[model samples]
Target: MDFERSLDLLWRDKGETPQPTRGRKPKLTLDKVIATAVALADAEGQATGSMSQIAKELGVGTMTLYTYVPGKAELLDLMVDSVLAERDLPGPGDPLPDGWREQVRLYADRTLTVFRRHPWIQGMSMVRPVLGPGLMAGQEYLIATVSDIGLAPRKAAAAANGIEVYVQANAALTAETAQVEQQTGQSTDAWWGQRSVFWEKYFDVDRHPAMTRMWESGGYDVDTCEAVDEAFVFGLERMLDGIEALVS
Candidate 1:
């Protein structure tokens, strides 16, 4: 992919690009094309969302879309960056707070928020890095926040990447679980309830003492299940503790 061209399409002044001389003025802008593609992908999985589908959504010919966006890959790139732009980070000139740990926590929460809002993004293959303006700014902010805590450049990047990966993976699991619940019309607790009869009948108490003890303690009860939000906080704090050890 031509990174420069993609960046131009994402961030540069649209008027600066030379207009076509012979053809009628294009009805669709790049933003419109990308927005339409994003909506299609959000509603349907990326595999089912195609150039033809986006064209139909925009009421334009498939070939005409090429005039605005080069192809699906580039369009995907733009879509990812466009969503990244929606992240409610601090404005350009604002200084990051000095509380590094809390800042990292907030960053992870924000990332998880993005993932939950656009669950389809968790499924996208990041084999090709799309360093559009929005993504670049996010990266800079994260690294700078870590660096402000006195970590070296390499460690800062690693720390930021680790937090991001943890948040994304957890958020993806949460989203998938929600999707399953929606499709099956059964909550996790309801599914466990359905299986409780069989479990009571055949559960091996002698062979699995630990499992037996946990069940007796009501650990498997629906009300005892760890909330997703609590799990996230617990895991995040533990991760930060490890990083804090290195910092100390």
Candidate 2:
């Protein structure tokens, strides 16, 4: 989609409900189309989420959806911005809360929340980012928060990007793990147990002494292992520590 068209759609007022037209009343509004598409993506995933699927979910013809959204690519851009609009980030003028580390931690946590809420978003290509208003606002908030601290502009921007990458990568893994558990109807421990049996049968422990030792030490046991939240916190702190060292 062209930049102008994307900007128009993303910046369109989603608050005002669609009004009845002169001839035939509109069956689907832009907000409805976006919401329905989000629901479809959440349920069926991005790969299976198609124009026809969204149209079927909304009980409208495929061509009808085209009037509201040009195509799946444009629709996806809308969906991304729509999801980002849900973020509860502090405004640029808002003061940094407590220590810089704490503020950065909060930022990471909030970003993770968005990813957890929309797992399918992780699948979308962020390489060529769609700089919609919602996403731009989020970036502004992150950079502002970091810059509000002692970090210089360049460092602050880099730090914010680092935090984002960490949160997104981990959130994607966590979401995938949850999806697997849900589909298989098995907890992580149970799934690991099944895999362990296969490893015990055919795997040669002699070849990988360190891995074997770690497995024997209960490092691989899901029941006793650190929770995802704990791991995230630990990793986040370490990442912050590195950034702090740089600042010092």
lDDT of 2: 0.74
Residue range 1-73, candidate 2, lDDT tens digits: 6566666678776565334223345686888988988887777544358788888899987878877766788
Which regions of candidate 1 deviate over 4 angstroms? 1-4, 13-23, 45-47, 95-98, 178-198, 201-203, 206-208, 218-226
lDDT of 2 at 156: 86
Give Cα distance to truth, residue 138, candidate 2, Å.
2.5
Candidate 2 Cα outliers beyond 4 Å, as residue runs: 13-25, 94-96, 182-188, 221-227
Q: For this target, which candidate reaches the highest TM-score against the unseen true structure?
A: 2
TM-scores vs. true structure, each candidate: 0.81, 0.82
Worst 10 residues of 1 by lDDT: 14-23
Write the residue-wise lDDT of candidate 1 on 1-248 in tens digits.
65666777777554685342233579977788888888876665432588898999999878888777667877788898887777766555886555878777667777677766665776665545577776776777677677766677789789988876787678777656655565477877788778888777987789899988987897665341366767888898998898888888
